[model samples]
Target: MARFKTKHTEWLLSNMAITVSSLLSSNPKPLTSRPVGRPPIEYVNAGPRQKRKLASDLAVHQGHNTSLLVHAAAVSAEKSNEEDTALVLKNIYLTPSDHNKVRKNLFTQKTDSVRLTEDEAFFEFVLKIAYRLKLKKWQVRDENGKKEMAKQKNTIQKKMWNAMALHVDKPKQNGNGNTNDGNTARRAFAKPKLLAEILGLDENLIAYFNSILIAISCHLPIDPTQFKKYCQKTVTLYMSLYPWFPMSATVHKVLMHGYQIIEASILPLGVLGENASEARNKYYKSDRRLHARKSTRQKNMEDVFHRAMDSSDPLVSSIYLAKRLGQQNKLPLPADVIELLESPNFLYPCNMDNNNNAPVFDANNSDSDSDSENPFTIEIDVEDDF
Candidate 1:
């Protein structure tokens, strides 16, 4: 027992410093109460009145049940203003709510009242189709098969780029030195007519894209009867083939809402394309970078404005317009393309007094003939390579 007590005492001595430190750290000193005193005369007299005033102010501010509806209304108005500003961003004119509403109307098929602008529809259709084709996944298990499929896909992509006169290189770095991974450039390189034969996509799918291209190309008024027929056939084919695939908003717009949108436009749909606007944007970037003054923002803007004015001046533009027109060596339109067009003559202007007349539509063109007998219809085999 004496030995046990000695051991216990040694343990206690060892832990005493830790226990004392923990107790000191954890236990804070108790606060002392202040002695109560009688209030001054001013506070004593005003206390009840002050308390009533504060309660009334709070009630008005909080919109509590009160007779002062004007104050309540003001509070509510201020709250609404705050909410309106919640989604307001600098430089962007549209609030989040407004943007959402526009997107909903644009993409959603539920609303028959809203219609996409010609440019919007054109780009949406072109970009969506190209993006879908490029990103399409093939089911394959063997390493060799996967490599072959990748090689085939790359070859097709290269062909598309060549057809569109585009050079595929590394993505360009922007002002912040970051490469933009967007497929905007890729969309421009889409030649669906070429893809139709080479990829062996459904004939209806080929005809559908062809019809859209014809409509876009047509400077004359579109025939509603022919347009409707094309729309119906294409939509039916798309629905049948892609029933299992997830449909995007743009696809829904193109397939379901296109006819109404096209019909609603007062001008020819081709005239409404944003190609010029897009070109102008490219010019602006080039002008700002190469020609504009870099010393000050105001000077830079002034120089850019002057440059744009000079470049776009009618006299300046006309001087080189003939030369620019002469440089173009466009290929003949396919027979199918001519058949789909509302006015083929618009594309082949006979009255033009120049040696560089646009190529006439040749029904027996070798390129068109070769398309019918394309050996690249191995796309079907590639799809089933698994």
Candidate 2:
């Protein structure tokens, strides 16, 4: 019993010494997670709201990287008066419940900022209306009784003439002439977005926009020759930049007319309106005397699809047949539905079909003449096209 007790005591002391030595030998101390600098409790108390605020800041940083959405926001801002931006910015962050507060706030704000809201944007969009509008020589008279409409592109006098052509033709019963017969004074003035600062009791924003619309009219003479390229580039850029902008019927009609001019005149005259299959048959046949019609068709289709794929519109078919098909009846298709569906391999390459040197079919082929053509003629055409 005495011997066993002595052994147990020796073993217990040895185990404790080993444990102490092991702890001392350990390299990295266990991390107790002490505060790095000041405790977070000294900052905003750690909570779900702090996490959410941090998340919102991160999202805003991401939003800045989204260039297209930022471009849209910039375009929306560009249409307003310098004075109204603060209100616009404030209202932009606000909801419908703040309407009364915003109205009261506008009354307290400066007047210049209160003028020209989206109407200015809409006006600027349709160039002929917003800027230079050609009028009848008799109709182009200024307050000085001279034809200033041609030289004075952006004068209020030009707007007045446009407005007269619009409103006087159909007078309103109200002495104030509030009714729109498709025309009103070319005033860019827009009142406060809220009701309290309104000059008119009715205070319909739509009416105000229409009055600005009336400042522009269908009578504006569009020079088909000079303006076609300008209009095309402008329309393409505008549509590319602002897909969300609400288009008025008048603007659509005008743009349609402009498109019609391009269709009638652009490359091969009257090519755009032709039936796609008919156009393909008439223009793209391998044996077409002047050129390889299929080659041109394929190139045009490729270019148009590349452009239209990036467009926001659903009705995007640059190919004549596809566009016509869309107009006639819709069909099941891919996401890139209207891309080039035809292959040009069968179409004669470089104005030649079968054998490189000789325009003869291989023993394996029978349609020799159908596959081949002379290239010297094709080369001349390409230069002419350029």
In Å, residue 1's CA in model 1 sits off its true spot by 71
- List candidate 1 segments past 4 Å from native: 1-200, 217-221, 240-242, 289-295, 329-331, 345-386
Give the Å shift of residue 153 in candidate 1: 9.4
How does residue 364 of candidate 2 score in lDDT?
Answer: 49
Kindly list the per-residue Cα lDDT of model 1 for residues 99-211, writing each as its tens digit.
67667766865624445443334434443343345335333567766666566656645765666544333234542211212243324414455545544455457556655
User: Whose TM-score is greatest here?
Assistant: 1
Give the least accurate 10-residue stretch of model 1, judged by summed lDDT: 175-184
Alpha carbon lDDT of each predicted model: 0.56, 0.39
RMSD of 2: 24.3
Instruction: For residue 205, give model 2's deviation from the true position in Å.
Output: 20
Q: Tell me each candidate's TM-score.
A: 0.41, 0.17
